[model samples]
Target: MAANAPFTPPLALASLSGEADADWARAGAAYAGAAFLGGIALDADSRAAARELVARDRSEFLPDEPITFIDRELAALGDVPIQPAFNVRSATVEPVAEAARVCRDRDTLLEINAHCRQDELCAVGCGETLLRDRERLATYVERAAETGVTVGAKVRAEVPGVDLPVLARDLEAAGAAFVHVDAMDSEPVIADVADATDLFVIANNGVRDTETVREYVEYGADAVSVGRPSDNPTVLERVRAAVDREFGLEATR
Candidate 1:
């Protein structure tokens, strides 16, 4: 079992369209224990894919030197109490390794992105495509682990023929410190993955009101991340209050 991240209430602000930078993290800092700051495209193939998404008017971070950009973004947090985590997309393992170095230097968590279902990203082997290739995804996790940063993956649920529980175990074996699951419509699957491995599980999707937050908590999620409504104080406050009420101080690590 991996040691839990220092996510106070164990709640996070999920990356939004690659725009969950420092400002976004700060905006939700009051309620969240951590914030995933990107679904950044880190290598040439992923960068090209990100550009394609941008062409379609989707938001993406396409910096010239991605490592520098990553360092800058993490640096911008400037001692916020919340854990700073970067969610990245890469077709190859090298970029993930490089980002791990930056994350290590900044004391940030590094998340590999296997949750993006974007056709453009998947076409380049950068996102949901990894969900289908367990070995490759594990290899990426293994390489990132070599860098000694707190590394993990943001995975999507309900991918056909993919057993997320098995995959979660594989990632745990590969030295993953945590697994952030986007439990699409199969919310109960959160329990399956959590049961499959001791890795810290962060449940995502439809995390709005107290009911939704309570559901994930009951399902064995060590934490929950708010998606589209991350910036909505009404929703985050409700979710935060629910988290505190459910998990309480004992939940803090």
Candidate 2:
């Protein structure tokens, strides 16, 4: 584990759209070093995008009073030792700042969402579009960092024309503490970003077993995040055991 990253065992439960709430975090608490709650819609544009997703029968968080919702959910996790983090969606900077303030009060991580590739979110400038708009994303990070909370960004890998290493470096310059990468079929890019920036890299995508865990570890990822199978204790336990063994090796060297 990276000494500066708060994720203890260096494993995270990646946020499932609308499913990764307080109870979900509590359930995975024993396995994950961090539980990312929500791909919550934080502003008008994101809320609109979320509603569009919901219209298509997809799970999307469209909470009324977004900041209060964050506070309430964090409070509900009462005494779970897992680090609480929110993966939030917004098309502008103010909501990111507001969400960061709530995270600061809770001592949780606030991750700006630039990884969601849903067309509705992209059309609204809330998801993968943010990854393409580097300056705007950096501004969001800068504002969130101002609140003195741990700030990070959830970014996608393999997006054409987007240099993730450069974006990671830009985010680091803007005061991000970590980068949660959704390595959509391009696992080696985790190494690229890890080599390019000091940001604690949490690699996501198809993480289920020791082989997967060891692969990310060998690729220079500081941690790995479980996405679809995060709810399965069998998988979490398997991955957690692997993390202890693999990351322990890193600690030794």
lDDT of 1 by residue, 98-209 (tens): 9999999999999999999989999999889999999999999999899999889999988999999999999999999899999999999999998889999999999987
- C-alpha local distance difference test of each model: 0.90, 0.90
Model 1 misplacement above 4 A: 1-3, 250-253
In candidate 2, where is summed lDDT lowest over 10 consecutive residues? 244-253
What value does the lDDT take at residue 143 in candidate 2?
95
Worst 10 residues of 1 by lDDT: 1-10
